[model samples]
Target: MTYESSASAFRHLLEARRSIRSFLPTRVPDSMIASVLQDAQCAPSNCNTQPWHVHVVSGSSRDRLSQALLAAEAAGRMSLDFSFSANDVHGIYGERLREQGAAYYQALGISREALAERRAASLRNLEFFGAPHAAFLFMPVFGDAVRVAGDIGMYGQTFLLSLAAHGLGGVPQTVLGMYADTIREELGVDPSLKLLFGISFGYPDATSAAAAYRIEKVPFEDSVVFHN
Candidate 1:
């Protein structure tokens, strides 16, 4: 692909992708998700090791997973395997995080003082946010973390873009990591392979409150740096 065309295609993709929160009960074809996963495998890796393993859940599996997650959360047995820390919260990225966090809670009618409400809201993450499909991406430690992370990023982008291309929508969820131990045990992933993140996929539910809650992205110039 030529540089111009490649840039144009990427631009289209950016405009097309959305962080879909509400999902339709209308089922998405398994083959479609499968094909997207196939494309996800196109991600580059160090030494072609391709260190991503995914587990897909839907139908009964999805329901069971949701039940397990709710149970774990209710029992206060949820372990924080990977979670965001507010250690350094004075930088640009920190500001961005705060802005989004405030916006999301406001959209959900959660208040600043409602810690229990926020915790309950967070538990929804393990429910795959009510989407029909939940996909977990894992990376096994084989020595080099940087290279594997790069590969994971590529795969994640490919998976999300492929879903958008197929007229489906999803949200890449890091909150799933909050209950990573429960999920890991439930999924029966090998001890070697670690959970990197997750994505919830399905047709967008236009009527849901979350569907209406949206945010605009920063302009391209503001986000990008140019050097010539």
Candidate 2:
């Protein structure tokens, strides 16, 4: 493709990509999954360490992992390699987070006061929102938080974009990392590997309520810096 055409296609792809929360039960083909992973492998990493270690679960394995995750959540069992503070999400970031939550709940017809409903909805993350497959992303710590996290972030974006390119959809769920101990035990993963997140992927259920919602992005001017 020519330069202009290439840029336009890329822009269109980026604009069209969205987090699909609900998916059809139909399984994605193994060949397609392999192809997507191949594309994701091209993602650049700091010093080419290429530290991402992924575990893709499907069929019975997916079901069992979901059940374990749900049980862990219900029992208040959480083991996180990374710390997250609610206090850090203050000011503008917090407002945007709240706004996104409101939009998502509204689209799903969930009431803010319905604690049970909220919990049920949140539990869907463990179920991979009915998707046929889930991939757990893990990486070994390099002692440098910024570089390690940055590599994983690039890898994740590449993986998601590859799914989109293949006419599939995916949603990244950090909540899955909360049950790291359960996941490690169940999947036979090394405890030394830190769980970054999980992604659920498959053909999207476009008719679902959650699929109809799209969070708006801030203006380019607000995020970009044009330095002379």
Candidate 3:
């Protein structure tokens, strides 16, 4: 393909990719999963440290982790490797978060006033929204997690894009990282490795409410500046 065509193809995939919250129960072919993993390995990291340590779980292991996550949520168990509080974020970032939440809840047919329903719907993250697999990304702390997290985020974007290229989709669940100790113990991960986040992946169920809507993004002109 010519350079322009190649760039267009990549842009198409990039723009088409979205967080897929509802998935068909069918497992992705092992070969396809392997190919996607290989593609994600190409993501660049600081000084090529390649700090990502990924664990993909399927079938019985997936179910076990889901159960463990739900139980932990019920028991108010939380062990975070990094700190995050919605209240700490404000202005444009917080507004964007609220907007996203509103759009998602609306798509799910839950009214803004339905707090209980929203909470229940949020629990679906633990269930992987019926996905057949989940991948947990972990990393070691070096100095601090900010830079490490940026690398992991890039890795996650590559993984998501690769899944899209392979006719699959995934939702990156920050909620999963809330139960760091639970996940580590359940998956036999070393204590030294801290959980970053997880991606639940499979064929997206187009008919599901989760796929019913996608919100518009801020226009380029509103967020970008040209300095010449």
lDDT of each: 0.81, 0.92, 0.92
The sequence of per-residue lDDT tens digits that candidate 1 reaches over residues 22-91 is 7887778878888888888887777898888889989998899889888887798856544466756678
| Model 3 per-residue lDDT tens digits across residues 1-228 | 999999999999987899999999999999999999999999999999999999999999999989998999999999998877888889998999989988999999999888899899989988988999999999998887789999999999999999999999998988888899999999999999999899999999999998977978788899889999
Instruction: State TM-scores per candidate.
Output: 0.86, 0.97, 0.96
lDDT of 2 at 179: 87
After superposing candidate 1 on the true structure, give the runs of residues whose Cα lies further than 4 Å from its correct spot. 1-9, 80-83, 88-90, 113-117, 220-228
**Model 2 misplaced regions, further than 4 Å:** none
lDDT of 2 by residue, 1-228 (tens): 999999999998997788999999999999999999999999999889999999999999999999998889889999988877556899999999889889999999999999999989988998999999999999998775668878888999999999999999998888888889999999999988999898999999989999889998999899899889
**TM-score leader:** 2
Q: Report the lDDT of model 2 for residue 120.
A: 91
Q: Candidate 1 or 2, higher lDDT?
A: 2
Candidate 3 Cα errors over 4 Å, as ranges: none
**If both were scored by TM-score, which would come out higher, candidate 1 or candidate 3?**
3
